[model samples]
Target: MISLHWLILSPLIIGTTAKLMPIKAAKKIMVLFQTALLAAVTMIFVEVRQNGPLLENIGSWPDTIGITLRADLLATAMVFLSCFLFLAMVIFVHNKNYADHLFFFLFLGLESLIIGIFLSNDVFNIFVLIEAATLIITILIMYKQASVSVYDGMMYFLINVVAMSFFLMGLGMLYKKIGVLDFYALEAALSQVNNPASLILPYAFMITAISLKAALMPLFSWLPKAHGTPSAPSVVSAILSGLYVKTGIYVFLRLQTTFAPLIDTSELFVILGFITAVVGFMLALAQTDIKLLLAYSTVSQIGVIMIGISLNNPAAYWGGLYHLMNHAIFKSTLFLTAGMIISEYKTRKISEIHGVYSHMPAVGVATILSILGIIGAPLFNGSISKFLIATGASGSWIESGLILINLGTIIVFMKYGQLLFGHSDKKEAANSDILEKAVVLTLSMLCFLGGIFGSDLIAILFNISLTINPLSYGEKMLLFVGSILLGLLIYRSLFKKRNPLAFIRSFELGFNEICLSITLFFAFMVVYLKITL
Candidate 1:
C-alpha cells in the first residue's frame, strides 16, 4: 500500500518549505525528513525483498496507458542507498557555514531526482529525471561560484545535455519502432523483432549516454573535475562519488537486462572495464592533490565494479553490485575525512600534509580504514568483493589482470597512507564535530565488519548464499600482503621522485574533442554490434 510517487514528491515539497524557513530550522527539518525517508525506503526494500516488485501506474491507469514505476530488489536497493547517503550527507553538513536553506533545497531536490530515476519503469521518464538532475548538479558544482571555475560547471552541464540528447534520440527510435517506452514492454517488443540489427543505433545511443554518466573511459574526463573541484563541499563530493555516479551503472545494468534476450555485450564491457581500471589508477598515481587522487581512485574502483558485472559468472555479477555498495560506503568516508583534513592542513597538496594520526585521530582512523577497504586489504570490504571477482575469473588472464590492478591500487594508497602519520605540532588537530566523528568511525567499522561477514552480507543483499573457498581465500590473503610490500617498494623507488607523468594529472579534453569522441564511440559500438550480433 506504500505509494511510490510520494517518495519523489515529498522531498520537493519539503525542500521548498525548508528553503522558506530559517536556516537553523531548515537543517533540522531536512535531517528529520531524510531520517523518515530512510525508514520508508527500508520498509519498501524489505517488502520488495519478501514479495516481489511493486508496480504502479500514474492516475490509477493501466501500465500501458500511463507513466509507470517499478521497484524490484535492485531498484529498491539503489533507492535505499540514495536515501541512506543523503541522510549521512545532511548530517555531515549540519554545522557547516554553507548549510543554508537554499543548500538544503538543492540537495534535497537532487535526492528526489535520484530516487525517481531508480523507481521509474518508463525510459522517457528516466530521460527527464536525468536531464533535470544534470541541471541541479550543474548549479551545485558551482554553488560557491567564487571558489570554483565557471568553466568547470558549464562544461559538465554542456556535456550531459549533449549526451542525454543522444539518449532522447535513442528513445525516439525505440518508441517509433515499438510504440512503447516502458522498459518491460520494449524488452518484450524487441524480443519479437525479426532482426536485432535495427536496434544497434538505439542501443548505442542509450549506452553512450549511460557510459558518459557512469564516467567510463574517454567519457571520464568530466568526473575528476566535478567531484574534486575546490568549490564542491565534501558532502556533495560524497554524494556524487558515493551515490550519484552509481545511477549510471544502475541504468547500465537495467538496460542490459532489457536487451539480454537480443544481444550480449558482456565481453566488450569486460575488456573496457579492465582498461578503465588500469588507466584510472595510472592517472591517480600522477596526482599531487589529495582530492584529485581520491577522485581518480573512484574511477579505478568503478572500473572494477563494471568488470565484475560484465562477467558471465553469476557470483561475479553479485560481487560487482556488492562492491558498488562497499565502494559507496568507504569512498564517502574518505572524502568526508579528506574535507576535514584539508580544513586542518589548509592545503590540498599531498606532499604538504602530515601527522593526521597526531592531530585528528578519529579522522585518521576513518581515512586509514577506508584506504584499507579500497586497497582490498585482507580483512576489509574491498577484499571480499575483489576475491569474489577474482574467483569468478578463476582460470582466465583476467584473474591475473585483477591481481595487477590490486597491486596498482595498493601503490596509490601507499602514498596516500603517509597522510595518516607525522607531527601535528605545526597545525592544530582537526576539531571535527562529535557527530561527524561518530558517523565516520561507524562507517569505518562497517568496512571491517563487512569483510568478516562477507558471505552473510552477500546472502542478505542478494538472497543467494555464496561460500568462499577457504584455500583460495588464504592464497589471496598472501597475495594481498605481498602486494602491499611490492607496492611500497615500487612507490619508494619510482613514485617518490617528482612525477614524470604529471601530464596525466593535467590532461583535459576540450568540448569539441569530447564531441568527436562521442561520435567515434557511437560508430565503434555500431561497428561492434554489426560484427558481433
Candidate 2:
C-alpha cells in the first residue's frame, strides 16, 4: 500500500529537492532517483502480480469519503511501462548539453502525474492530475522558446483545458446523480439504476472530452502541431506519442466499462475508429516533416487500437492492449531515431535525409525494425496483434477496414523508407553515445522478440491462451506482400506527382472551430445514446 504512495510521490519530492542543487549534481541525482523509482515500480509490479491488487484509502475515512489508490494489474502494468520509458529517456539524454534543472523538474512532475492518473480510483483525483499533466506538457513543448512553439503550446494548453472542462462538468453530474466519485461505487450505482438513460448527458460530456484527448478524427488537429513542434525535444515528442495520449485511451476504457450497464456504444466507436485511421494515414502521407509524419502515424495507430478495443471480442481486446504496448516501444524508438537524424542532417525533410544506412547504421537499423513493426509485417509484433484483431473480426467488413488501414500505413512508410537507401557523397561521423544506441537497440530487439514469442508474451502479460493458426499465416503473408506492392505502386505513381494534399497539410482549425467541433460531438453522442439506450 505504502509502495504505491511512494511510487506516486517520490518523483515529486525528489524533483523539488533537486531544484536547489547545482546543475551538474542535480542531473546526476535526478538520474539516480529515476533508477531507484524504476526498481521500486518493478517490485510493486511483482507484488501486485503475486498478491492481487493492493488498495489503500487515505486516512481512516469510509470508502465514500476517502481517496483510493489501487494497484491492480492494469494500473501496475501502465506504471511499470511508464517508469521504464522515463528511465530510458533520461539515460538517452544524459550526455546532451541541454540539461536544465527546470526541465528535469517538469519531466519528473509529468512522471508523477502519469503514475497518479494510473493509480487513482477517485474520479476527481484523475481529473486534477490530468490537468496538471497537460500544463507540464505544454511547458515542455515550448521549452526552447521558439517563436512558433509558443503558439503551439498555447493552442495545446487552451484546447485541452476546454476539453477538460467538459470532463469536470460530467464529474459533477455523476456526483449529483450517484452521490459518489469512486469508480466502483459509480458502477454499482449505475447497475442498480432503473433508467440508465438519465446519465446520457454526462456520458456524452465525458466521452467527448476523452475523444479529443485520444485525437480521434476532427479533435486530432492539435496533435500533429504539438508533437511535431520543431523546438520540442525528441524525448518530449516520444513521451507525448508513446505515453501521454494513451492516458485518454486509459480513461476512455475505464469510463466505458463503468457505464457498460447503461449503454453499448461499441458499434459507433468502431465506425469512428475506421474514420480516424483513414484520415490519420491520409494526412500522414501529405507531411514533408519527418516528425509530423510520425505524429500523424500516432493518430492512425491510436485509431487501430480503438478499433480493436471497440470490437469487444476477447481476442481483439487483448490484441488492442498488446498493440498499445508495442506502439509505445516502437514509436518511441522511431521518434528518438528521427531526432538523431534531424540533428545530423540539420533538416526535417524526409526527402533530404538520404544514405542513413551509411551515415548512422545503428539508427538506420532501428528505424527499419520500427517500420516493420508498424507495417505489421509477418513475424513482427504488429503482425501478431493485427492477426488477433483480424481473427476476431471473423471475415467481416471490420476485417476489411483493418486491411485498408494497414495499406495506408504501408504506403506512408514506403515513402519514409526512402531515407534508408541511396548514397551520400559527404562522409559523416558515427554517433558515439552508447546510452542512446543501447536504448534504440533494446527497444528494436523487443519488437523482434515480441513477434517471435507473440503467443507466449500474451499469456504472460494477460494470462490469455491464444493459438496461432498455421493456415491463416500463409494468407496473411500473401496479403502483406500484396499490400506492400500496392503501397509502393501508389507511392511512386500517385504520391510523387504534384502535391495535391497541400490544403490538408496547411489546414489549421481556429479555437472557435475546435470548440464548435467538441460541442457537436457531445450533442451527437447524447442523441445517439438516448436512442440506443
User: What are the root-mean-square deviations of the candidates from the true structure over C-alphas?
Assistant: 1.3, 1.5
* Residues 15-100, model 2: lDDT tens digits: 88988998778878887988888888778777887888888887867897798998888888888889889988988888877657
- The worst-scoring run of ten residues by lDDT in candidate 2 lies at 424-433
Each candidate structure's TM-score, on Cα atoms with residue i matched to residue i, is 0.98, 0.97
lDDT of each: 0.88, 0.88
Candidate 1, residues 1-533: lDDT per residue as tens digits?
46999899889899999877888888888889999998998898889889999998999877766999998988988888788888888888889998788888889999999999999999999999999999898888888885464677888899889899999998899888889988888888878988889889999999998998998887888888888888688888888898899999999998998988888999999988898899999999999998899888999999999999999998788889999999999999999998888988889988888888778889988998998899988889999999999989989988999999989999898888888777665654467898788888988888999899999988877777898899999999999888888988889898887676687855678899888888788889999999999
**Candidate 1 colliding pairs, count:** 0
Q: Supply candidate 1's per-residue lDDT for 391.
A: 89
Q: Which candidate achieves the best TM-score against the true structure?
A: 1
